[model samples]
Target chain A: MALHPYDPVAGAALRNVPLAEVDSKDRSLALSRPWQLRPSLLASIASHGILTPLRLRPKQNGLMQVVHGFRRFEAARRLGLPSIPGLVLASRNLLKLFLQALEEGRTARTLSSLENAAALRTLKYRFNVPEKRLIEEFLPLLDLKENRRTLRLHLDLAVLPDALQQALERGLENETALRLSGRPEDFQSLCCRLILSFQLGKNRQKKLVEMLDEILAAASKQEVQSVEEVWRELGCAALENRADLTPADRWKRILALLRQARYPALSRHQARFDELKAALKLPPPVRLQAPRYFEGSSLEISMTVREARQLDGLARELKRISGSQEWEELFRLL
Target chain B: MQPYKPEKVFVERAVAESVITRNVLGNLPMAQVEWIDEAGQMVDKSRRWNPSIARAKQSLVLARHPGRFFKPCPAGTTKTGRRNVCCNYFVVNFASNCHMECSYCYLQAYLNLPYMVVHANVEDLLDELGQVFSSNPRSHYRVGTGELADSLALDSLTGYSRPLVEFFAGFTNAALEFKTKSNCVENLLQLDHRGRTVVSWSINPPTVVQAEEHKTASFEQRLAAAEKCSAAGYPIVFHFDPLIHYPEWEKDYRSLVEEIFQRIPPRSVPWVSLGALRMPPRLKALVRERFPRSGLPLGELLPTEDGKLRYFKPIRVEMLSKMRAWITAASPQTRIYSCMENTDVWQKVFQSQQPPSEVELGDSLLQLL
Candidate 1:
């Protein structure tokens, strides 16, 4: 069998290192490793012990620093294991060590979008990888388009605040999070809070983000300075006192306020239409429809009939509706 | 005029032999090039392409149009006893998509191509136009290139208008119109148009342009360009289509009309069209998705008989009546007409209960030429 030159175990010794003596100073740049430990992995480590050895290198302080297997070290410490199996490497190539950790993460299915972005950043800044290679080679590794635009969006996602990153990790969509991140920093936190409080699904989160963005644009057009001002003008705080409303209901109310702010004409048209509909009070079988956007000069009245008697009944209903002044007003509105 | 700089250029192998394709490639010297054997394959591949990122990067495609280059306008007869179709109006599609983004643009729903495509086979288009023109030499034809793409938006790179203007110059029966929201008329100014080409602008109020028409020339810029065209012995036209119903719209539109007449002579402006903001039912969702901050699609819209969404009749009447009044006051000699409107709207707007015959309306516009 041929020995691979880049094997992790090549010229390295496997030994049990005390978990307390392992330093994580250089771990901040590890792209593949997640910040928070997984409960399933912790439970597995507690029951079956560490199967893979942690990759470690010696530091100037003489304490071994973790190069990979950060989760395993944390889990072992939590399990009260004084020492964990570690592979001690003599090499100090950060890029090679980071790639090795990334490979392990791929095998373990732990590398997320954030991790992918971080790896691309490390390759670009620390290792001086060309942007062309990053876009063409690294973006596809994360199932993103092999383009500079996607690369930039993923890079933007990498530096988001920790809370938003955690939310992303907990399954808020990357696109939704990206949209939220495009807002002002103050609005981003407020939006994230609303999203977390309601526990919105991906579609709802997208809608919320869109509605918030529209509100912001409207406020900007109105010369309102901040989202805080929008919130105050919209009376968003009053939603808190509606104790009977569920989170979804509260979210709906908030979205309605935003929509009203965004589309003043549509709101007014809707109110007038509702008033007209109420005034018409047509029979159950009859329906009156107006042209869309109110841009065309046509109104349609539809009705259903089963027999001659029903036809006569519909005609009488139509006559009654026609006789009402609301009919004239409706035509005038049209 | 500032030429459009596509980030990447894709040339179809079929159009590689075309002169227009070579011209486009030469114009965009720094663009990354890709060659494909079939234009359909490229179109199919672009269906999955995300324009949000690509458009931000200014990536574009230059390919040959695989289908017919010339076709009649689709604004056919409506159920409301109105001839919505413009008689004898034909479209010469030099391109498929626009680089500019308007919130209420129907192209957002109409075009599926992810990138802006300039059809490279313009010589073939001219040949087709020749056949149509010769087949009906007696009838006056209103041919336009702005149906799908903005006519002047890519004129600097494509140089399509020069040949088109020169082609129509020989014909007394045919006139070419280039409708656009762009100010790229510098190329057209130097051409021997011979009063055969009409350079028109799709204008709106400054506020509406700012809010909805993204990456487009400002209203003042468009007006200045129109004034230049008018001075350069070319007939000018104005289209105030997709007139948005917003707060202070009357004030905005009135001032817009005043500005137009104040700048360009009304005698040079032969026609002015008014079309209210209306879209198909499916376009509402697309607009909301593509332009999340746009309030244009949130108007009080209901489906009309032809399956397009439009405003209620009274709203349309009010907008058109006010526009007609303002436009007439500004320039009484400028002919005003409505596009895609029914007979009732025409009667209400023109203050004539009797609907005019389609022939009369068509002749009225033709007389301007």
Candidate 2:
């Protein structure tokens, strides 16, 4: 195979092609999803009439395939324009055309996360580029770290359901999305719904997914199969649909329920500690706390003294609790 | 257990003429051998090689260590610099990795060198120890060779144990322990260890052996080896370290205790150490990625103060206490202690508020003998 030096945009003749003859449905050579005609782009094209020509390659039956400018092409079609300016290239190589499309898209603006995944998926599956080449050569071209995990993540992200991708566009983190990519569809959908409804931050999003995953794994030993069943069994489904509560409160309730389900013994121990602490009747400015995870050998008691007189009451409470049964129970819990 | 037949062997040029290197190459007659200038450079160049830890174990490297061979056991202190109740132990890192792959092995996150490394300069190690021992004639030391690698996993090929056993036989102030999970005790049967060397086995229940300990000796094989070593007048020690939690762990561990006492004489065993399953945070992800079917990550593990994931305090306490009880019932005279535990755990297990110091723990083991 002889190597040819090819310029993707050089020597391309610009022509005005009728919108009816251009077939944007054939996205085999496309590096992005079918044109999402944004309002601004539509307005720009509607006023200026497609100033920049759409990139096209001639089909055998006097038809043209839109390669790079799907948005501009869609805008022209919707605006009832008869013809749009386009550049028709002579080269028929699919890989070169894909690269041309990718480079053009990249130079126009940074590709969105989905567009990056789309480019990688097309380069790998459609153009028959080896994965090693994609990871080593093309990943760097797309400003991705050259590693298999990155390649796998982007490839996985490209194949997620449209709703989940839309959720990602709505600011669902890519890292979170990659984590949810491997779960069943129902789990992914439920998680996406929760994340969107609660407007979960990055940490909360991560915690929600991890809690559900671990709960499902633990429940599987008892013959439970799905996250939905675990949710319903833990009474999280009812809390999930509790319209009376705010999204924030619902998220808190659902997360607390999941955490309890995940760590039943620890929850019980914590509840016992809370009960003992309450029974001790320590007044305000005095807090009794167990060690994190009850891993320490002793409990911690701290009193915040705002005034000199407050110290007397704190001292009294502390002295009273020193010989209390609740104190002994708290130590025993630790 | 299957013999470790590495697919390739890389020999550092500095140790190309070493006896251990020659012995290893001689045993691996069909392996592809390459002579490299430096092992560290080789490792640095291969940093990007992202092979599975198990697959990386299939390549062996025989290199000369450039650093001191002896150090204090890392378990003496937790990662947060909190003092742990260690056994005043010292470690001799004669190798860098283990051939047998355990799902929870810390070397999965500890070792940077991908290939299994055996330091070929054994005579230098012996000479350094000889110097250290002569300088401090009255101090007693309990040194182990299983800190960075299994002491006996590569014994068949390297034959490093014979010299070590024979070397420690000359000293009265230090005891050498060859801790391993392998059944390679054939070489020890013929060596005169002079009661200064103890053969320790890190044993688990049969279910754990089958499920997590991949390509290592089975429980019965380890027990039989213990019996053989005991018969040869070598003191036998067992470390039930990384005792995993499961639904029937108590039953399985009780069976393990009963079987060991039934076979080996109680007098030949010195002490047993119990450690609950704990690991650094990074190892959890590696375990999930490498051994997805493992039940290890399913346990309700929480991060302790030391930044290592462990069973909850109550669960660990219950498990360790039960293990102590079963071991004590099986061999009343045999001492039991906890490994890498804090003072609180030690006190709880022993039903005492005060715990022993490191030197006291070491001296107690000697007094038991």
**DockQ of every candidate structure:** 0.16, 0.66
Q: Write the per-residue lDDT of candidate 1 for residues A35-80, one digit (tens) a residue.
A: 5788998999988999988888778898998877877887887789
The TM-score of candidate 2 is 0.91
Go through the candidates in order and give the clash count of each.
17, 0
How do all models score by TM-score? 0.71, 0.91
Per-residue alpha-carbon lDDT of candidate 2 for residues B1-369, written as tens digits (9 for 90 to 100): 777999999999999888999899999999999999988876765665768777888889999989999898988778788877788889999998998878999998998887899999998999999998889988788899999899998999999998999999999889999999999999999888889999999999999999999988999999999999999999999999889999999889999999999999998998989999998978987887777768887787888877898888899999999999998999999999899888888888889878888888887886665
Number of residue pairs clashing in candidate 2, backbone atoms closer than 3 angstroms, sequence gap of 3 or more or interchain: 0
Task: Kindly list the per-residue Cα lDDT of model 2 for residues A1-334, writing each as its tens digit.
Answer: 1112343455577788888888757767654554345889889877777777777888887889887887777778788899988787777786787787888788879888888898999888888899889999989998999999899889988887776788898879988898787778888988998888889989989888877877787777679567777778899889989989988888788878887887777888999999988998888778878889998887887878889888987897688778989888888987
Docking class of 1: incorrect
Q: Give Cα distance to truth, residue A326, candidate 2, Å.
A: 1.1
